[model samples]
Target: MVQAEPETAACMALRDELLGPLRKQTLSTEKLCEVGRLFCGAPERMSLYGVAAPHMEAGGVRVRGRTAVECTIDEYAGEAADAVALYAGNLREGSESDPLVVDLFCGSGNLGHHLGRRLGRRVHASELDPQVYETARDNLSRVGSGVEVEHTDYRHLIARLGARTENDVYVVEPPWGDAVGAVGLDLTRTTPPVADILADILRARAGKSCVVVTKTTTETVCDSLRNAFRGAAHLCSFAPSAPGAGVEFHIFRLGATDQP
Candidate 1:
């Protein structure tokens, strides 16, 4: 007597046929490590999976303005990971309704892939580096949304988002390449600051509610950002628990304003 939703039916079928089995089957890191060692003829191959293998495997050295520091695997930050988890939690309420999620500075597309698979929505990712962009494109393909990747900088993200008005939720991880005022004359040991990118997004679309996650630990930079963004900024530190995880990251929820 009751009409069933088309999306719901399709999702149930997908779960029964695909994901249910995957969930039941556990991936053994130890086995993967053994295989990696056997394939590479090096026992250390397994340890390489931490935060350096992907870039090393690509044979890419640091280039452009990103070379002053040593390169680490562009692994997804824990806060960004947490944000995705929370977003997934919200989706459990309604099976059929999936929000359009956009991820900027999507290095290797790991975060986007997780989001796309979990929420069953079209995922869009943008990256700056050609090498990294290709990597993201390849990684996202594993999740079923093909050719949805774009190679671009975060500065032009507003224009891209305008064209895709369907994208209501934004998951951004802009490049924290330099510390505040560290471009030309001023320089600091700060790894990556998330304020400039936040300001740009705020200036572009102040009315839209965006969930932004940034990874950085420069005190001066943090102070500057907190002073600049005011109530929208919140420090999300995971050090006490996840010791080897990452630096203290910032989470900002942009406030609604009449300005566009």
Candidate 2:
């Protein structure tokens, strides 16, 4: 008989607890953070085995209706994906000597954090939620000491970036309420649709080789952007093929025609 590894005890204990019929009825982003912190502190041996942990303490957990879900550090919509996609494509296309890139609605500064590391430049982020904004500030501070995070609505982010136009690269991950209110989203009345926000950013850019990325479930965002930018758009679309999920994920890219 093979001997059990030293970590087997803790790993099995964790597996049993996590696998037991989901008893965490009080779910919120704060609660998620607490759990994440606890889990992260578990013995390194346990963590290395199979008890997966978040990269950053979970900002929070989200609860809606009767179902509850945990929010990982990078779980926010287009948060990680947008930054990574842009870094590989448009963000890399421009040299570090170019203008700064702004990440509007920069929750936890994930997009900006990744952009700064990739391009070796500053990434300005705008966020509104006090808790989330603070979290982003801390994260970005470490990634790029030059990162500037403003705790304000994304609508005002452009003005701030416009003032710092040495190298203008814009990346955004607007909130589209998934089942979880991870982004402090008010799902009541969809006041400014994602498309409108994209249009607003496009206008505010004022002709710079900007790279804008957004996450959405409908083709409407692409259509709207195309109409507004006149066929100057690159769109990548993907849909989860799991059961009972009909919505798709769309990555829309609109580059600046003229570099200022």
Top TM-score prediction, candidate number: 1
Q: Give, for candidate 1, the lowest lDDT window spanning 10 residues.
A: 62-71
- Per residue, candidate 1 scores C-alpha lDDT tens digits across 36-92 of 233222323322213232233343321111210111122333335555556423443
What stretches of model 1 exceed 4 Å from their correct place? 1-79, 87-98, 142-147, 163-167, 178-193, 218-222, 233-241, 257-260
The CA lDDT of each predicted structure is 0.42, 0.44
Q: After superposition, how far is residue 71 of candidate 1 from its true place, in Å?
A: 8.9
Steric clash pairs (candidate 2): 28-61, 29-60, 29-61, 98-167, 99-166, 99-167, 99-168, 100-167, 101-169
Question: What would the TM-score be for candidate 1 when compared with the true structure?
Answer: 0.54
Residue-level lDDT for 76 in candidate 2? 30
lDDT of 2 by residue, 131-196 (tens): 556655664554334458898987787854563342355654554434222222222213355556
